[model samples]
Target chain A: MGGYGEVHYTNPTGPGTPPVASLARFVVYLAHSFDDRLALRSELEVEDAKVEGGAAGGEVSLEQAYLDYRLAERLTLRTGLVLPPIGIINETHEPPSFNGVERPGFDHDVIPTTWRELGVGVVGTVPGKVGLAYRVYLVNGIRAEGFSGDQGIRGGRQEGQDASFANPSFTGRLEWAQPGWKVGASFWYGGTADTNSAVGRGAFAAPVTLLSADARYERGPLALRGVVANVSVSDAQAINAAYGQSVGSRIAGGYLEAAYKLLQTLSAFARHERYDTQADVPVGVTRDRSLARRITTLGVTYKPTWNTAFKGDYQLVRNAAGAGEHQVLSLGVGYQF
Target chain B: MQQPAHPAAPPAKVAASIARLFGPGARVDTVSVDTTDVLRVSRADSLLGFAAVGNVLGKDQPITFLVAIDPADRLMDVDILVYREPYGGEVAYEPWRRQFRGKTAADSVRVGKEIRSISGATISVHAVTLGVKRLLAVLTAWHRSGAIR
Candidate 1:
């Protein structure tokens, strides 16, 4: 659970943007093992405080539903709805597992954390000092019609609905890890336009590709991490003119975070995040500075147990437009079993 | 969904690890842990050490690993014979595994302290640390109670 209060600083003396408290999300993870070689895992989530099942309500969706089969010591087969092996949190996010009250903006706007799709894949590791892991999958692709000027591909994610397969996508990740250090790279490439759908009546397949990389280091009481991500769209000019939306040809951003444990159960962290959902537009389209966001967050997390945490953070969000900068104070508590 | 229950290291891998720890010519015995046989590495019937393999949850899935303890109850070495998770393979690295050497129950044998933590592999690091702690505790008990000599 999470709640935050925000005040716009664009006009310091004037009335600020409203402050609000919200229960951000509730999620449940389930897994069942059939034996030593096969298992099933799933995550069901509720966004916002409630879901009325009527006109005005929150949303409920499945984040992961997959089965894993161990084919060998280093190789495994996985099928069903699975989070693409991208970014740091897309596959490992269980609330208590992270440091901030909310996820990094780069993950939300660029990499799209919790981005799962119906697919099948192989995941394996090569052991030693130069430990390595790799994943490759064939999955359903996004829809261009859902792409927007403000959210970029955030809305384009089909989330494993009756997803189209006119042009399947491929997502892959590779990581190299050593004592106290890990570095990884991931990518997603596919066609978004449905050649058969009316929206693509006369347009070529609009291919969308995303590339990302991250690194982390932890030793003793200190931890450091950073991530960089960018999405490039082909045929954005025509697609924007046809859909009347300003989905940029490129959206990019990244973040860096550092944390130190003051005590066994208490830690202080600071993060800097920057992202521009509309970083680059088509030749004739205008860029919206507001779409480009940068924020510095300071926070502390208290963990009474390994799988539970209470967090509080203050975010100083800078407005690129220089019109509505704001500060947000947030608190949250989370647990996982 | 069929999951692996009590998934131990494969026989060939277990044998190879034992030979590596002891010598290639050392004698190996299979001692019974309830109904399951645990590997006992030795030379000419004199006990060199015991090889214990077990599984613990690493993030969402189980990580299977082996622990080798010398006669004095100190860890000789740790070898990740089989790891089922996707992200925490760092625990299998030789340098990271080497950190647990010579540690006993008297030591914390916990991550973020005695054992260095692996970034992005926190769960696996913690799990293995706890596993080593538990192994030491069991070995200490056996030594004190005369179950092991």
Candidate 2:
């Protein structure tokens, strides 16, 4: 039932081969400004999508389609298919705008990048009257399945996981910058509800919860950043009899990273990440017996132009059951308008 | 970006100078400037503060001048320097900057109240304008009077 759903939305699995998700879309944008103090801008996108690989693109649906208003010099609000500010990469999700063909492997573990919902946001300069000029933003929460990784480890925030209605949630960031120096801090909090029938003859759900924070500093061509995040769910009322049985315990993870720019368009970076699910930890340090996952990455990013990048890297992965590692090569292309 | 002190300067003298102005915690470190790593002050901590305080300086172009009630007050003076900004720098040069001389701090703060905003760089103009106004107040009352020395 999970893989394949209602027949009305599901087109035949081809002439009987495999089903394909069809997400047709259209978009338009308009922008104008006067005296720079005031500006008008808008965007519209239409979506029609279906799962492609798993059950061969599960169903057809409308994904993201909205309009935005850059009302004042530093404030912008968007509704309709409202974009949710999830992680560092998602808000800045233009393909050509980042390092790898895709975002980092760790970012998705909590806040799925590019996950959008019907909501709104405000982005602009932080007051400006105080001291250093800083920028800040607040956005809505995204759909559950839309917030996590393939296995729901990163951002599996499925509570109130409505594809149609976005729940009340907020994400924000503040940054201070000078000629060659920059520093920033960001936070995220939200609520969700999860439903499943794994334990009962009838379907039921558990509550979805999340909290996270991060900080970073950049000087000249060098940068350093750290993040700590957690996903929580009180399965006490879980329909699944597995309760504390099959389910390990809780969920938490975080990482620290550093990078150096080799050129205006190229950078060398290394990151260390740790995570654990179905277990608990003290001070972000995992205490589970053998369910710990640690990933260390070393890579280089080449940007031939402002909006595009080429990346190559290797990750050293360690699990409590002894340690081993592998190299995965990635190629990706991205852009924004 | 803050200026790097000359390499020939004695390390102790450089440290003393920096501490005089920025206090003791400020330490120089290696950082990528453009594409090469060079030893200088930590860019992460100061750059943003610098950018916030940016409006005063011109880009790549440097101009140094002393400010005092009279030329005889050179020893008790305030030094104003401009660098690295193309569009807004025009406001800091000649015709516009000339308006700054001999005026009190209340003279041109908002720019809108006393002077017209620069055409191309609004934020830069405002920042620089405000910095100049504040610097004048600081120099005339404190630094020139030896409070900083």
Candidate 1 residue lDDT tens string, A1-337:
1111111112112265555555566777677767667877777877776688565866788888888898987788999998888889787676666788778877787887779999999988765425788899999888887788878887878788898777689999998877878899999998888763534542236888899999988878898999998899876777787788888899999999999999999999999999898888888789989888998989999999877888888888885896677777777777765
Candidate 1 chain B lowest-lDDT run of ten: B31-40
lDDT for A98 in candidate 2 is 40
- Candidate 2 C-alpha lDDT tens digits along A1-337: 0011111112221134343333232224333333222333333433333346566424333334444454643355545543443335544444443444335555664555445554555555445432122222333433233222122333443222354233355555554433323344455554333222442221113434545655555555666766676666444223124322223225667778788888867888888877665444223233444446677777777767533455665666566655333344443333332
Give lDDT per model, in order: 0.78, 0.42
Tens-place lDDT per residue, model 1, B84-115, is 65456778888899998898878866677777
**What does candidate 2 score on TM?**
0.49
Q: What is the C-alpha RMSD of each candidate to the true structure, in Å?
A: 4.0, 17.1
Worst 10 residues of 2 chain B by lDDT: B47-56
For B43-138, candidate 2 gives per-residue lDDT tens digits of 344421110011233221222322332221111222223232212323433344444555654444455334344322333545556656665565
